[model samples]
Target: MSSPIFTTPDEVEAAFYAALAHADLDRMMAIWSEDDEVVCVHPGSIRLIGLVAIRESWRQLFASGARITVSATHPVRWSNLMTAVHTVHQHVHVEGDDRLHPPIIATNVFARGALGWKMVMHHASPAPDMDNLHSNDSPHIIH
Candidate 1:
């Protein structure tokens, strides 16, 4: 599939999760920047750098043929003309799993290039139990 011009960071991000829901590796990688420095860190996994490694990792994940759903919540964002950073809570559910998995905290960075916004980095780690607690300073909310 030819890459579509993703106009906004939100649009690219939406596409990112949509791709994950279907395990569409091509569509997933399409949201990433073509830079060799691109990064991805899955929950409990070592950091992966570059498109080649990233692609292979996703390929292996998809190879499992598991139906996975990812929902992004509690997003905090910062952006300029060329770069955007977003932190969100990723709520994932896998088909046939009875236990609830703790939400994963993810920071995704995007860069605006000639092809529009493309993700350059994605780092996700399992959120601690304390993070799931509601606080006076902030309420845990999902949009």
Candidate 2:
């Protein structure tokens, strides 16, 4: 069966995580655009550009045979007619592990094409502690 056409960036993002949680390679790739400009940065790993590199990177990761539970929260988004940018706090729980991992900050970019909204870039990095994240709430000077 073929993948469903994602009509919105939200749909694409949802499918991306669902595929990841299941280690479904084909399904994950379906959410990404086929453009050579597409990019993905997996946490601390080097950036993967183009479909071939990205696919191979994911393929290697999925080979580990561990399921990852990804939950997206605290979303901040910006969109126009053709492009959209979404930033969210990503919480990951590895199946069978009890330790809590720090949240990750992720940015997903999507573009509209003939097929519909497809993700062009996904960049994720470790997020700072909540106190550090809120430290800049006001302008203060160190004595």
Candidate 3:
């Protein structure tokens, strides 16, 4: 089996979500680095360490047939020669669901290696309901 070379962090991120939307486990796992310490934390779940754990979690999720489509936005990024870290708000929608779920805040970390950029970590959790933010009169503070 051949893995595609990802030229940049952006490309890896795009493919990550695309794989999730398509429920393709093979494509999803391809975005990750095969070595070093890898980790993933899904919303409301225990932290998953190593490729085996991460792969199983995603496989189970895809097996459930949710067909989730995610739109990642509001990214804050930091990068250097060998690694990159990015935080984005992910709006996930199930194929037939009409009720809007609050965006999930995700931190994606990537490393540059022989295979180009590959994701090393992905942590996603529920964000506060954004609808309520617009109705408040008090100053919204972020730290």
Give the Å shift of residue 131 in candidate 2: 5.1
Which pairs clash (backbone N, Cα, C closer than 3 Å) in model 2? none
lDDT of 3 by residue, 22-141 (tens): 999999999999975899999989999999999999999999988899999999999998999999999989998999988899999999998799999999999876789889887888
Model 2 Cα lDDT, one tens digit per residue, 86-124: 999999999999999999999999999998999999999
Residue 117 displacement in candidate 3 (angstroms)? 0.5
Each model's TM-score, in the order given? 0.89, 0.89, 0.89
- Tens-digit per-residue lDDT, 16-128, candidate 1: 99999999999999999999999999999999999999999999999999889998999999999999999999999998997899899999999999989999999999896
TM-score of 2: 0.89
Clash pairs (backbone) in predicted model 3: none
Location of the lowest summed lDDT over 10 successive residues in candidate 2: 133-142
Candidate lDDT values, in order? 0.93, 0.93, 0.93
